[model samples]
Target: MGYVSQAESSFPAQVGKDFEEFIALSSVHCDGWGISTNDRQHAHAVLEKKVEAAAESATFQKVIADNAADGALLHLRWATKGLSISENNTHPFVYGDYSFIHNGSIFPPDSFSDFIDEKFKKLIVGDTDSERYFYLMMTQIEKLGLAEGIKTTLAIIKEHGKTTSLNFMLMNKESFVVGSEHNSEKKPDWAPADYYVIKYKKDADGVLFASSGWNQPGWHTLENHHAAIVNRSTFEIDVINL
Candidate 1:
């Protein structure tokens, strides 16, 4: 549902072929589109709160071209869990300084509410499992460091709850983290194989991370249940067990 690029260099003026193909595959995902970028302002983001498909939105192209950020997170929403269609539900949800998005569903959607801190509960403005996943990670990050926070949160989701797919991207001004984890063997008929596949590559300018639907050349598929962590300044990357 989203794509992430490392912050070492400027992003393309327009969204690329991979994005176009992704949208063409399903225009229904066009509930709304949001982008999180590390432009002059750290972790700044923009949202197009329209009901039209993003690939067909002139505003989407103009904003993307106007703000060629060092790092960017692009998301297209496909409503699930009976969530409503609105900008507030769109992804790249900002809390404190972090921007987060997800490509999977968490079973028992509201279960994470109890795990969320009372203070952070007020920060939850959306009704999607992805947003809950983001806040859950935030709660852990508030207690532990970034990596430990995500690691601990994921562990709980896998053990205590049922995650059809835990694939996600979480970014701040300094760096970003992404994961490719899911129940590949137990998918329903409606869930496509592309839903579980994620690919990553260190491009000439920076790095690229995305779900398989994008179809960018030279991207290597990430192993299931593994996460990639990349630093913004140094561009150092590590693939760790999730």
Candidate 2:
């Protein structure tokens, strides 16, 4: 599982300043770190690298803090099978104006590629199931809108593959979506408490969504198969069951 933070209007400065604190909290799921901060228009810049090296960079921390973005997404990865540890395999995969990060593993990962549309197959730069899932998401978004696309994508994955978790954060410049999904009836040994839970809450700044490790004061766990839809401009959050 990975950790993600999506912010609107305010940057979670603590995420950058207290990098070690986050590392300690999310150490259970660790591999790479990736972030994409969006500008007023929703355009974003991405930076991702293996954690050991990224955590040591003063530049990385500075970029995280200095970005006065309206919306931002950050991910700390835990490698699944078959993928090598490299920047390409990092989270927060971006295409066009959309950015995505996930915290679940699609079992029998090889089957993921078969679901991708031919147009998106070429966009895949990494071997992680998360990236393939991202492409499938893009295809869904084209057919259904964002929120429904996310729901449909998860449903299709659950129908075709066995996934330990299907949690993800998908965002562009204007809006963002999140989900907390898992095979709760037959939870896998590797699926820790944190993997099945997603927490979020509204603060003075805006809404913050994260995995179990973040020390959020009023955060509430998103129910299984449930999702949170956030409007970046107004900061209104609506919770829906998928």
Candidate 3:
């Protein structure tokens, strides 16, 4: 889940309330959970992670209940095959000013190595493909800026990977960016048609985005292969095609 409220720093109480309900879905995504909150640009995010089911962690509930942020991203991991359920492999992977979480699989776990910058690759501590995917974007961002970097990375993965879903949220202190892409035909056999769907709701408070699993009747469905970025200070959204 990703949230960007009106510019300034104020924690909307509804996020915590809604997330409490979201945690129940951990029955399916039961490996681990992580969260990152940013109040504004240049400040360190309030990042927390646990290698346990979200519903079982008191710290998870307390962290959500206490921390305040203008922008925040949350993840409940259903560990990809061959990955370990450890803190090192948890979501909301942080690198400098950016926090990232991805929901998908990229074939050939090392497929992104050739694309990552040497320095970024050195920073990787986890063995999950998601962490490598993050570095791939960071490497591209160094040359193409945020949107283009994300676009290029997804394009490359689409061309080379047998992707299940590349849906993800990448946020820094100044912007929250979401990438939505997936092979509808490759949806999990036990999941619903909308299991890979991503949706959002914008109101007087701000915009809230999440993967489709629970009830989100009025939320707008973010189209597949599209990326949306929310400016942390202005709350302006830039919708781009990937």
lDDT of each: 0.72, 0.70, 0.83
CA RMSD of all predictions: 2.6, 3.4, 1.8
The CA-based lDDT of model 2 is what?
0.70
Worst lDDT 10-window in candidate 1: 6-15
Tens-digit lDDT string for candidate 3 (1-242): 88887654323364544555677889888899998887675557678999888889888888777767778888999988888889988999888778999998888777768888999989989898899899999999998998889988888777776789899999887888888888878888988888888998777778788998876767798899898898776778889998
TM-score of each: 0.87, 0.84, 0.94
2 versus 3: better TM-score goes to: 3
User: In angstroms, what RMSD does candidate 1 have relative to the true structure?
Assistant: 2.6
lDDT of 1 by residue, 180-232 (tens): 88878665577667667888777545677777655668778888988888886
Residue 93's lDDT within candidate 3 is 87
Instruction: Give the top-scoring candidate (TM-score).
Output: 3
Candidate 1 residue runs with Cα over 4 Å from true position: 1-17, 40-49, 186-192
List the candidate 3 regions with Cα displacement exceeding 4 Å.
7-12, 16-18
